[model samples]
Target chain A: MINATLRELSVALAAKRISAVELATLFLDRIQRLNPALNAFITVDRDKTLEMARAADVRLAAGDAGPLTGIPLAYKDIFCTEGWLTTCGSKMLSNFVSPYDAHVVERFKSAGMVTLGKCNMDEFAMGSSNETSFYGPVKNPWNTDRVPGGSSGGSAAAIAARLAPAATGTDTGGSIRQPAALSGLTGLKPTYGVVSRYGMIAFASSLDQAGPMAKSVEDCALLLNAMAGFDSRDSTSLERPAQDYAHDLEQPLRGLRIGLPKEFFGDGMEPGVRAAVEAALAEYRKLGASTVEISLPSSGLSVPAYYVIAPAEASSNLSRFDGVRYGYRAPEYVDLADMYRKSRAQGFGEEVKRRILIGTYVLSHGYYDAYYLQAQKIRRLIANDFVEAFKHCDIIAGPTAPGTAFEFGAKSNDPVQMYLSDIYTIPANLAGLPGMSLPCGFDAGKLPIGLQLIGNYFDEARMLNVAHRYQQVTDWHAQMPKGSA
Target chain B: MSLNLDQVERIARLAHIEISPAEAAQTRDRLNAIFDLIEQLQAVNTAGIAPMAHAVDVSQRLRADVVTETIDRREVFQAIAPEAEAGLYLVPRVIE
Candidate 1:
């Protein structure tokens, strides 16, 4: 039962072979056994789990179940849950319980899904390795000493450990894909505004997108079908009609034109990751896909640009937490302003404070045009480069990260080294292009290497089709780290 | 592009985040390194290029000014408040 894909789990539920309560209990037991080491979950309430599962079972009994109904999934802590703590991995929000469901949570509830608990993330979604999370870093299931990539590291690690069959993640500059790559799960980040951002905690408004993370492309597609749609609450939400993101999962890949970015394949890549990505491309060739070399000249500038833009937005968004209305407050203060300063200074972790300072410096009177505005122009060039390349290729392919997961404190001391880990995955977010990552092959040390597929704007269905075809030909996505399951 | 201690202090004040002298010194070093990374953007020839706010070219959607949400959860909202008084939030005196 634990080994089944999301589709098989749903099938078993429909056949009455397993009840939702039983499934939730099974996972809850596994989490109890494994969670101490991984630190993937921040909140796990068995009472709440059984309550939701009981309702899901009632819906299943009435024959009113959707494919995901009664399916237990992990919600990234970034999303607001009505009563659950949505900390966004910061002490600032540690005690803040949501008053309403985020748009994504509402949709999942409507589908009659069971929420297992809130998964951990980086503090305000600011770091690459999950170490900045107020809770603790999530360990890679493959190796206890190494990190699971972040800020969606908990979601990725949960799925990798089979704690949750499927989960949700938010990507602002590769939070979803990079973590999924390290933890060996299938993760997708839809085109911007494709998924509503109403309840998800704001990171970089323009770059943050909520999507699915699961064990298989088919599972991710099914979750995306529920997640992606128009929402009036989010001003930027696209007004496009609902899409069945899984509609083309079985499509053939004959004549698929794959563009390999020259910058991504060159110097920065680790040899093991390069070899794994090459092997996956070879598999695609056998499936009748042709590869072409392409250039995204300005993509190398993505890290700098993203740092400026995301933090500028985050500084503004996070200002709402000024120790007054909600969240942490200084126990003692000389005045209201002193309260705000002390609370925020103490509430936010080191990386969050660093980014806020940088944001304030850039958006300040003198530096706005030089740093913020200049980076936006670089952002335009990066997006334009992708637009030009897409004219010749159906999809772009690359290694999701330069290397496999690293030990804690490896790059945490140097933020630039940490930022470069996301160099390959950031371009897609900058372009608002749909991107997904799945296990291509494992490194020599057995860590997973993710094969990234970047599609044109709103081309998620085709990209999933591309991924599903490759998944069908390879067993990498099906492999698991050594565990009792 | 580097940020010195005084600039870091002023920026922290501007952002409303308090920092000790020790933290400010460490922050200056880290912020300087980040800015050095960002300095590479200046190397690009971006004259007359429009700054991109969003990747997609969609404008903000307009909605009617009429009230759409009536949840009226001020009670729920204030329930999480660190301090509240008379159905309003309690805070330190802003004016003398």
Candidate 2:
């Protein structure tokens, strides 16, 4: 039951082999047992979750249920679920219960999926490791001492630990892919405008995209079917026709052309990780998929440019929390100005405040032309590099991170080193492309290695197809950490 | 490329936050390390390149000039800090 995929779980629900309430209770019991050691969840309400499961059962009996009906999934704390604590993993929202549901939450509810609970994350999605979470850091289930790659660490950990069958995650500069890589799960970040960001607490508006973390590519496809859609509330939401992401999952990749970016294989990658990724590429070659070396010269500049662009947008988006209408406010202040100052100072975590300051600095007068404008031009070059490279191949393959999850606090004090962790994954986000990380191999310590596959804009189905084909010939995705069950 | 304490203070003020002296010094060192990494972009010859802001080249979509009903200001201000007995967010009296 713990290792059951979403498809198997759906079949079980339809056959009355197990009810949604029973499934939710199994997960709730597991979470109650393991969550203390993992710190993967921020909020879990047994009563509320069972209530939703009962509703899902009713929908199933009514014969109006969808594919994901009665399946349990966790939500990243960033998405505001009405009446649930949507803290965004920060003190500012620690006490805040959202008055309305985010667009993604509404879609999931409409599909009749039961909520497992809200998962932990880095505060306001700022840091690469989950250590920056105001609540606490999430431990990698594979090795409790090792860190889980984050800002989506909790979602990845929850799925990895089998506390939930699947969970939602938002990627801005590799948050989704990195954690998924470290935790040995499949995570997908769809095209930027594919998922609506109506009430998902803003991090970097242009780059932030919510995607799914699950056990397999097929499960991710099913979750994406419900998660991706057009919403009029979000200005950037794409008005594309609804797609069945699972349509091409079983397609053969006999002649697929995979482009391995030469720049991604350059120095700065751990030798063990490079070996694992190369072995994965060899498997692809054996599967009748040919590989070619392509150049994305501007890929080296993605880290620098992303830091500036993401923070600039983040600073502007976070300015809305001024102790005015919602979220956290200081208990006492001398005046309105004092109130804003005290609230922000006390509410935001250190990393969040640092990003806000950097963002405001780059976009401020006199610096905007020099810093913000220059970063914008470089962002275009990075996007164009992908455009040029995609012309040569159908998909791009690379390592998700430079190395496996490092020991916690190894680079905590070194911000530059931490920022470089997302070097390979950021360009896909910058280009508004779809990317997925699938478990390929493990390092010497049995830490997981992820092979990243990036596709052209709105080509998520193709990416999932390639990943699913690869999974058919390998058992890496099915490998679970010792003692998880 | 290292930022001085004064510049950090000024940036903090412009960002509408207050920082302590020791905090500014620490932030200066951290920002210096990050700025050093960002300096890599300076190596690219981006002269005469048009700055791209949004992903797609599109103009802002404008909505029709219709009167959208406004929410009750009094109700909204009810949650506002420093609110007085009336519908306003009260601050200390500015004028003597």
Candidate 3:
């Protein structure tokens, strides 16, 4: 059961081989035993989990089960689950138990999927490492000393540790893909509007996207089917006809054209990661797909542009966290202004504060044109680069990150060094393209490396097809972390 | 383009977040370093290029102005709030 895929679990439940309560208990027990060392989950309620599982069993008995029904999945704490503490990994929300459910959470509940618990993450999804979380940094299950990539670090770690078969993640700047890469899991960040972000704590509304993190591409594909849909609540949610995202998984990869961006393979990538990616590319060549050298000339500016635009939107979105509303409030203050200042100062982490300050300064007087506007224009250039490159290939392939997971505090002090972690993955978010990371191989340090694939707008099925084919021929995605095993 | 301690404090004040003098000094250095990285945007000639505010070009979808949330869950929502009084959020005294 621990090694079973979501499909296998569904079949087991359908065949009356396992009750939802039993399945939930197995994972809950595993989490209780394993979570202390990994620090993956922020909150776990066996009673709540079993209660949901009992409902799933009722649905299964009534023959009203969906493919994902009765399956257990963890949620990144950013998504507000009703009655669950939805701390976006910040002290500002450390005491905030959500009164309502995020649209993503609502969909999963309606689909009958059991909620395992909420996973930890970087505070407000601000940092590349999970160290910024108020709940403390989530350790990589592979090697506890090394960092798990973030801001979806806890979700990545939970799945990597086999504590949860699947987890949800949000990506604004490689938060999903980078961590998935580091932890040897498959995670996809769908097209910007593909999944509704209603009720998910807003970081950068334009860039934040919620998607699935799991063991295989097929699992991610199935999870996306339930997660993607239009919602009246989120103005940005795309109003498109719903279709099966996994329908093309069995499609042949013959004549597939994968774009290899020159900027991705150039300097900045470690030798181990590059070699692993090259090997994955060679394997794709053996699968009847060809590779083309493409250029995204403005790709180098993605990190800088992202740092500007994401934080700008974040600054605007996070302004609602004043002492008045739902979050934390100062215990003592001279006036309303002082209350806001003290509450925020004591609530937010250093990285979050840094970004908030950067956003404010850039949007402030005498600097908006030079900083924010210029970044926006460069964002156009970055997106245009993708448009031009996609004309030559069906999907883009590259290393998810520059290297494997590093030890804690290795790059934390140097903010620029930390920002560069998403160099390859940021361009996709900037372009609003669908991007995913799957385990290709491991680095010299035995940490996982992710091969990233970026699909054109709304072309998720093809990307999943390509990844599913690759995963079928490789065992990298199936390999388990030693500690978790 | 680098900010001094004074400017750092100014930005902090504008953001409505307090920063100690020592924190401001360190923040100024970090912010300047980040600006140095972001300075690359100035070199790229974005002349005549339209700034892309969103990935998709969809217009804002307008919903009916009529109220949709009929449920009165004021107590439920305010249950987790720091302070509340009879369906109203409480804040520090603003009136003299």
Rank all candidate structures by their lDDT, best first, as comma-separated numbers. Answer: 3, 1, 2
TM-scores of all candidate predictions against the true structure = 0.99, 0.96, 0.99
- Fnat of every candidate, listed in order: 0.89, 0.48, 0.83
Model 1 chain A worst lDDT run, 10 consecutive residues: A476-485
The collision pairs in model 3 are none
Candidate 1 lDDT, A330-399, residue by residue in tens = 8888998899999998899999988888888889998899989999999999999998999999999999
Distance (Å) between predicted and true CA of A478, model 3?
0.3
Per-residue error for B45 in candidate 1, Å, reads 1.0
Candidate 1 ranges with C-alpha deviation above 4 Å: none
Residue-wise lDDT of candidate 2 within A328-389, one digit each (tens)? 77888787777788889889888888899899989988888778889989988999999999
Model 2 TM-score (2 dp): 0.96
What is each candidate's DockQ, to 2 decimals?
A: 0.89, 0.50, 0.85
On residues A1-485, what C-alpha lDDT tens digit does candidate 3 reach at each position? 88899999999999999999999999999999999999999999999999999999999999999999999999999999999989999999988999999999999999999999999999999888899999999999988999899999999999999999999999999999999999999999999999999999999988999999999999999999999999988999999999898899989899999999999999889999999999999999999999999999999999999989988998898899996868888788888899999999999999999999999988999999998999999999999999999899999999999999999999999999999999999999999999999999998889999999999999999999999999999999999988876
- TM-score for chain A in each prediction: 0.99, 0.99, 0.99
Structure candidate 2, residue pairs in collision: none
Model 3 residue B14 CA deviation (Å) reads 0.2
Which regions of candidate 2 are displaced past 4 Å? B62-96
Better of 1 and 2 by DockQ: 1
Supply every candidate's count of residue pairs whose N, Cα or C atoms clash at under 3 angstroms. 0, 0, 0
